[model samples]
Target: MESEMIVIHAENAPMPGISKPGPHQRYRHPVISVEKRRLGALHADEIRVQMIYAGLCGTDVHLMESDPQTGYIRSSAPANIPETGRVIGHEGIGKVLAVGKNVRHLSEGAVVTFESIIVCHYCDVCRKGQFNQCRNAKLLGLEKDGIFGKVVDVPAMLAHDVTPIIQTDQDLQAIACVEPAGVAYVACRNTRVTGGDVVVIFGGGPIGVFAAMLCKTIFGASSVSIVEPVSFRRSFAAQWADHVYDVEAFFANMPECIDVVIEASGDLQNINRIFRNVNANGRIALLARSGTSLVLDAMDHMITNAISIIGSRGHLCGAFNDIISLYKQGRLPLHQVVTHILDGTDGFMRLVGAIDSVLYENCKVLIRFASANGRS
Candidate 1:
């Protein structure tokens, strides 16, 4: 049986009064209508992706609940997307089904992936190689149409060469997590963590686990400690970290302080406690999403201890290469971090509406979609 066609909004396009779309909008924004309108028209750079797998991200949940009243609008759309409605799936990986004119990088069956941060190349930030912060950044799945559907046309430039890293269609599918993993990879890289050290990490979410895992695989930290209150998440995160304890337990743990602190959890209280555990002259990279707020004793910490805090937004898809290298070397265990695989529609909706603790006990949850031409 064929599924109903869906009509989705282009990226960054707010529905009149709504500043941002939420889970309700998923039911409201019909991708079927858009497909019906251009039933047969060729999308210029469209290479209908058979969404093998896409990971569930925290930002996706926030966007699902976003209140338009409180949401802020950007000044312009991304440059690469001359057209306004770009599909947003920064964590998407799939096979290229059909290609438009002049698109040479991909082929019909090549398994590929990319980060969803599509930027307006003309923006100053983009010109400075900071495309993630481009004045006109239209993130995949955030600003435009996302990869939750069976068929989505992504901007050509936004797509990366995933041929070498993605081996099987299944592996290509799990690569959806590559985007956020790239985030952890980039955050750690920015810290330039090379020497042996002890690391403290906050949050036990997927990103938190990835951060801890890399601390083991990439930096080979002597001791890794994670601060998390959730029992399941803590137990799950403990598999990777040397010691996983309650967030409140931080005051008691005695390790003489850590060399680095990676704050993956967006909770302000966790952020505050993380500062207390970091050794003077240590580095802390903040990798939470937008709208997360924290009031820290900067003068006390910075002046007294000389701590360096680096704020990172949007992972450079470049980390996909690094993640790929780690996977090939058999250094990182991606299977532990990835969980649940659902058919696109159900998975997409469940992630939006019913993501409670019990649901996300698994490390990663992925969604699979059909080919653009409506073929599996």
Candidate 2:
């Protein structure tokens, strides 16, 4: 007999007041519904997990607002839209309930979190040890059934057993967020931030905040600053960065002083101006995904100054383990980053409302399952 479980489902629908794609075409919001799904037999290389907590990501919001014409999430490439609505979410932690016969490393009752990108090991990029950029990579929430369900069967190789490092409920919360924080970790690593380097990060979202935290604690940067337009986010960023400034305040006095710039905000409008703030021989890492084309008119200046711009994608496979180690050492103060934790049992609309309202005041919102209610 199959067990029934609740899952969040996402599907595309046409935007109101718009008929066809044009210059001002506004994409419709994804039709979200809460439904019960019946689970089938677990695969040989998979482990069944009962989710405890799941983080709401910007990518989730993007997937919820996919382009009507292409059926793809706007600004993101190589993602397919399933003909039927799909379960949505990737960043989460859970307890293992059962393990496949072939899964030797993990067993029942182990605490685990997953690598969101399911890579095809035979791909050329995977053979080159660039698994994150696998040509045949399938994103968990985007291309397959994801962890939004109460129970999910995950590939054994993709599951990271965090049971050893989890000392407190806070640790579990941080582990749930490891997927996004790992992205920030890769961003900082890709830029090669060293001790004494002065860094400025654009945007004060969770990834931006994580980058700032890693720059200070792990990389030993001399100073880290955050430039964000939202006052609420600025307040949150102030806890991790040396200085937090609104857009105008940042530009007035800090031009040409930064050694590194990490762009975590996908705000293309102000991206061009950030080039003017980097000192000669400086580096910038872009971590955001946007559909719009970036127009950089500062190519001449960039060439003359010897500045480098790097594009960073998802986290490398090792990043998850590295972040888990940092958490074990208690070096990462992740408690400050999670601003809201809502009840997953509250149903689908509450989750949707939280996602909709995250822009104004929330930073790193999480949904807690019933099992996690009294733990910590």
86-114 per-residue lDDT for model 1 (tens digits): 34345777677677786888777776676
lDDT for each residue of candidate 2 in 182-255, tens digit (9 for 90 to 100): 99999999888999899999899999999999999999999999999988999978989999999889878675
Candidate 1 runs further than 4 Å off? 1-40, 66-89, 164-170, 290-292, 350-353, 357-360, 370-376
State which candidate has the highest TM-score.
2
The Cα local distance difference test for each model comes to 0.64, 0.78
Residue range with the least summed lDDT across 10 consecutive positions in model 1: 73-82
Estimate TM-scores for all models: 0.80, 0.89
**TM value for model 2:** 0.89
Candidate 2: Cα lDDT at 306: 95
Q: Which pairs of residues have clashing backbones in candidate 2?
A: 75-291
Model 2 scores what on Cα lDDT? 0.78
